[model samples]
Each structure stands twice: as structure tokens, then as C-alpha cells.
Target: MGLIVTIIIGFFVGLIAKFLMPGRDPGGFIITILLGIGGALTANFLGRALGLYSTNEAAGFIASVIGAMILLAIYRAFSGRGRLTH
Candidate 1:
């Protein structure tokens, strides 16, 4: 039950992140889902460490999206150099 909810939320989070940072991203739905989940985890961890969020309060959707965007930026930075646009 919890897992299903996570997946569903992850999907939407991924979509929102992609919409905000439009570009030629690699992979499809699966990747997007992973990105979303990763983003949420990242935000949760970082926020907790920084005292911005409590254990009872997981990172919200906005933070998740922001985290996804950050990951996307890093992905592009590393992968962009290896690919030829032309």
C-alpha cells in the first residue's frame, strides 16, 4: 500500500520535474520514476540533516521537484560532454 502510493507520487513528481526542466533527457517513464524517487529521498535526507525538515515531515513535493532538477543538472553536466549534439 505504501509502496504503491510512493510510486504513484513519484510518477507525478517526475513529470513535474521534467516539465520544469525541459530538455532531451535520457530514458523514459522508468527513469523518470527513479528520478522522482531519488529526488524525494535526496531532499528528505538533506533537509533532515540541515534541520529544515523533521522526521515526521518528509520533504514535500516542491522539494522533491527541486531535488530532481538538481540531479538532472548533474546528469547533464557529466553526460553532456560525452555526447555530440550534431
Candidate 2:
């Protein structure tokens, strides 16, 4: 149940981040969901390590979006794709 909730939140966070970023992102819904989930998890770990968040706490919307963007950027860089743009 908790995992499901986290995924759902991550999905929306990914979509929102993509929308906000206003760029071309490779992949479809599955990719978006994965990106979101990855971003959330990354943020969660980094925040905890930095003492910016509780161990069990989820990241805020903005942080999640930023994380997603960063992940997306890294993906593009590794894949030799162009930068994302509106």
C-alpha cells in the first residue's frame, strides 16, 4: 500500500516536472513513471544524507521535479541525446 502510494505520487511528480521543464523527453508513460520514481528515491536519499529530510519522509513537489530533471539530464548525457527543450 505504501509503495503503491509512492509510485502514484512519483508518476504525477514526473509528469509535472516534464511539463514544467518544457522539453523533449524520450520515452512514453513507462519511462516517465520510472523517471519520477527514480527522482523521488534519489531526492529522498540525498535529503536524508544531508539532514534536509527525515528518513521516511517523501520529497516535496519542487524537489522531486528538480531531481527528475537532473536524472533526465544525466540520462540524455549518457545516451548522447541533445538537451531537452520546450
lDDT of 1 at 69: 81
Task: Give each model a TM-score.
Answer: 0.87, 0.77
Name the candidate that leads on lDDT: 1
Over 4 Å off, model 2: 83-86
User: Which residue segments of model 1 deviate by more than 4 Å?
Assistant: 81-86
Worst 10 residues of 1 by lDDT: 77-86
Local accuracy of candidate 1 as per-residue lDDT tens digits, 1-86: 99988998888888898899888898798999999999999899889999999889899999999888888888988988435577
| Whole-model Cα lDDT of every candidate shown, in order | 0.88, 0.81
- RMSD in angstroms, all models? 2.3, 3.0
